[model samples]
Target: MAKRSNGEGSVRRRPNGTWEARLYYEDPRTGVRKRRSFYGQTAAEARRQMREARERLAAGAPVADSVMTMQEWCWRWLETTVAASSRRPATRVLYESLVRSHLSLPPLGQMMLGRVRPSDIEALVLRLRARGLAESTVQRIFIVLRMALEGAVRDGLIARNPAALVRPPRIERTEARHLSVEEVSALLECARGTRYYSLLRLIATTGLRKGEALALTWDAVDLDRGELQVRATLTRIEGELVVSAPKTAQSRRVLPLAPAEVEMLAAHREQQAVELSRVGEWQQDGFVFTTETGEPMDPRNVLRAMTTAAANAGLSDVNVHTLRHSAATAWLEAGVNVKAVSALLGHADIRITADVYGHVSEAVSRAAMVGLSDSLREPPRD
Candidate 1:
């Protein structure tokens, strides 16, 4: 066979009937002729892969040795990169689960890192969707995969991130569930005399997230001044409770408390003092919401209690987050400044507040439309 030109690789059929394309190049250090081969079921496919490899080489992208599998690089990338990042413990756990359980599955994991193509990623998405995973879940998986592969690119393990070229599954935006003011009243009534009563009321009035509310300490609360400082959040990581900083720097802000909330907290504090005296040696965790022993309230217990309260109140599909949603909706409808609402909700930006709750106040929107229409119309005669 005649020798091919420098840029043109040679394609040939093997005895096993598979096609292979070979690219001959000089070793940069040794100046010795070396060859790399790409195999495919068809000659055209192999040739195309070889052409891509040649282009990548011409562009100065270092080709990693073919011995490194996707699984190997992914694990290395996770251990040395993602695990060392400053993300929350809960977030790190989720990332770890995605890599260990989903990304390292089957033929994809066994393939060479440099040989992973966009079609492989697309197929993975299809398989996940077929397995009944939600679109949002699949999208999250893709995010982890893309980030890990980006690390690979940065590490010079791969010339490019194939996952970057594949589109993530789209998720439909659904309106967040919230209770009405009357529903909130009913749920609170059901929660009355229970340990979570004060906690539920605080969340409903202040719009704090479940974790943020659970993470509160007495030192951060000022009953006399009617203020609550959001300093941290509580999350469950690997079956253990983890207290971490707020989701963002902006999430750690001071929120004004209503007069009623101040009174409720004062009474709760007195009640706690009584309970502490009875116990004689309380753990004194200093959290605003705690068990009878003064330890931080377990979020799971709170969730269960909230679920029961919601059921008793005759509200369907309500959860702890409903308290926050209800507060945001009520405030927006009451004409509170969007920026104020954003700050109160601890959202990183006002746009998030507007996007989530802007159209949720249907009654307010209707009233504004009617007022505008009436103003443009002729007034009633006296």
Candidate 2:
């Protein structure tokens, strides 16, 4: 038997030759009695562990509680933290879907959050690879998990963030394809009589993203000034269309409309007015581009329309975004400054514009040298 210290508790030697140590203290914050215990073959080891436990509790560290599973914490993390962030709605929906459909399964989701190790995350990534997920998607999952675990650490629910120790899969960049001048002309000619003629012309002339184009409203268009303001975008989230702020602050830009594009948009507006009047009870969304009933157009539907228009135009497999690339490439070929192009495309940095359009400029420079040589070799015909 051992005497209790200051009426706290005792470390006593049991009959089986093992020592039992118990401590009881009232929590300062909760005012509730808290108890802990340690067992050891020696009283000294038992007392040491017990003292360490008490110190840990006094330091405001989390005691072992009900184990929080990964699936449980992930839902709470999404609902309570991620859903309230300034991220675009599409991004939030994608994160939620990725967690639910892929991450919350089997050994990974069933594991306790506190007990999750780096090896577990690495294994999850490996499993994703084996399951044929793209490296980019796997990397995104890693990022989402890292963010969720970081939130847990910030909330003081976890002692350490295991995600910090795991490495994300690497992704390789694929080269973007741009269209030729003749191809752009042919595509524009094909869109001449279609319902989306103005929309196609606008995108071909300006390098605005698909979302930016869809979110355009009549208020953002200034025909008098020959400009269009890009302040918001329409994106699909969980199969629902949502209008939200642009992905980047730089993405909110004003693009100058070509003369032909402005005239085409004016004609299209008149046609849309007639169509809206015909459908008296249809939804009247204020979108610049809409379905016949004035409802917002689905982006995927627009993509399909673009594809059909391209095929009809005698172009093979040219995507809608290729129109934007063609616009940038054409401008670069015509001696536009990279900085101006960067501003037109709403790129965060001029380096991005240069990286994508630099080759076109190089070809232009080569042609310029050829022209200079031809002029010098004119033989002074006098």
Candidate 3:
């Protein structure tokens, strides 16, 4: 046994041959008594561990606590932390779905936050991959988990976030499908007699998204000017149709309406008037696209109508969005610049327009080459 006069510590072996050391000091900030212990079979080992503990306390390093589990911290994090931060309703819903569906109750959540290692995150990702989740979805889950643990680190709950040390799975990008001109014609011809035929034609010609088309009002259309104003979109939130601002600042746009489309819309408006007349004192909403009862058409119903029209046209697999792509392709083929096409499609950037529709420009280039060949031909000397 060794003891220093200044109240520094030493280890002593008891009669039972067990080595133990006890050290007492006052907390520098609060002047409270702080006691620590080290136990080992040999006095030397106990003394060494006691010295390490004292050094760590002096350095203000955190000691790992076995009681602090990931599950506990996550609950506290969601309640005390995330609840205080303002997030969009849609974003909050997505976060709740991810946490409840994937992360809330698990061996990973049960493990102490400090004890969780990078290997644990890797194993979790493997499990997600085995369950048929796409790499992108698993990567999103990893992001949510990392953010949650990072929050814990900031709050002094954990020493470090293990999730940050793991790599997320790589995601594969698939090219978007666009309809050919023939396919577009076939689809339009199939929609001929159906109520939504004009709607499909409008989508194909004007490149209006389904939401934008559904949100159209009679006031926004200028038949004489051959233009339609896109100022809002009908989107479903919490299972109810809500009219909201355009998806992006640039999404509000004016689209030219062909004379034929104007006529079709005129006839459709007449039909809607007759239907509204039969409603007998019902309030009339001035939406250009609506149900027979003069109520705004649900975007889902518009999609279904388009799907049925495509099936009748024998283009069973074509989605409503394919019409928007077809319209962009048509404009590109007609020599519209990528920037002009980007504006027409309400894309945030011309690069997006070029990336998706640049292939159509190849036809324009071929036509130009033919024109150059004809103009460059040399006349006979005579």
Candidate 4:
């Protein structure tokens, strides 16, 4: 039997008793012939959809005829979109690593890009959680997946983004531990004469992130004005250290230094000058913090020094970042405004400061309650 050939489309009954109308057209982008099938419960409905599809294709509009797989689209997005994007090098590296290490796998990676549904992504999240992955890691994976799918949507490979329909797992917030005034004093004392003494004290006093402090140069600091400028941060990428702009615009800030910190920095500078003179040559980069060889100290070395000092001071569970948390908590307890503290910490939002240190300062909360009780007390009639 000869099959009926329609100029526009062909209608046939599928095995499941449904009608399918397939329209053949040439893709405007690739100039290649492609076929798109429209299914319906009835032949009339199928024909109607096929007519619409034909009209769209004739008008140079794209039809859903892509056979690109998820793996293919993901790689394209990574190489063309993510790689060519204006994202920071560190961020690009992180996204690339996440896609290569986690997203490229069987069952999900090999699936058709257009066929990925919310259930498929949710299943991936569940599987990651079952493998004891952290909520933040799971969320990062989902973020990369969503961004890739967003690119596919932009390119008309899929009508809608399935990742947008599914919710990533919520990250659990952990309270940061801060040291007490006495404990801070003891720790700084134990760190006295050590290479990390000034670095630890600077972080404790100004709340500068370890990377930011390590990346600082003498040019960014105005010792006479007692101000320290934060413009860039040092981060390790692919086992190599790189200095880049702060994470956000708000992170670039000028922080005031305490008088004692200024004096300490002045002395440290003089000491560095002597060390450089003895070495018979000056280091080109005038970074405030460096090794005896006048080279930038590795952040890991600073952390190890801090940890050893903390152990000597009888402090438990204290790391390099504890100094930063301690500063914020102390400022809040001292009745400093949250917004001021937020700006001092180089936080992009005041709400982040509130969320992190607002309720965690039990001493401040207790003082507030005591003051409220005092105000509510009734005066005795004389």
> Per-prediction TM-score, please?
0.85, 0.82, 0.70, 0.88
Would you list the C-alpha lDDT of every candidate in the order shown?
A: 0.87, 0.82, 0.77, 0.86
> How many clashes in each structure?
0, 0, 0, 0
The candidate with the higher TM-score, 1 or 2, is: 1
Off by over 4 Å in 2: 1-35, 38-66, 314-317, 349-362, 365-382
Q: After superposition, how far is residue 108 of candidate 3 from its true place, in Å?
A: 4.0
The TM-score, computed over Cα atoms with residue i paired to residue i, of candidate 1 is 0.85
* Model 3 quality (TM-score): 0.70
Clashing pairs in 4: none
lDDT (Cα) of model 4: 0.86
lDDT of 1 by residue, 232-336 (tens): 999888878889998698999999999999999999999999999999679867988999898888999999999999999988888899899999988988888
Task: State which candidate has the highest TM-score.
Answer: 4
What does candidate 4 score on TM? Answer: 0.88
- Candidate 2 lDDT over residue span 315-382, tens digit each: 88678788998888888888787799889999988877776665644567889999999988956666
Ranking by lDDT: 1, 4, 2, 3
Q: Give the per-residue lDDT digits (tens) of candidate 3, residues 100-170.
A: 77877687877887788899889889889999998889998888889888887676555567887887677
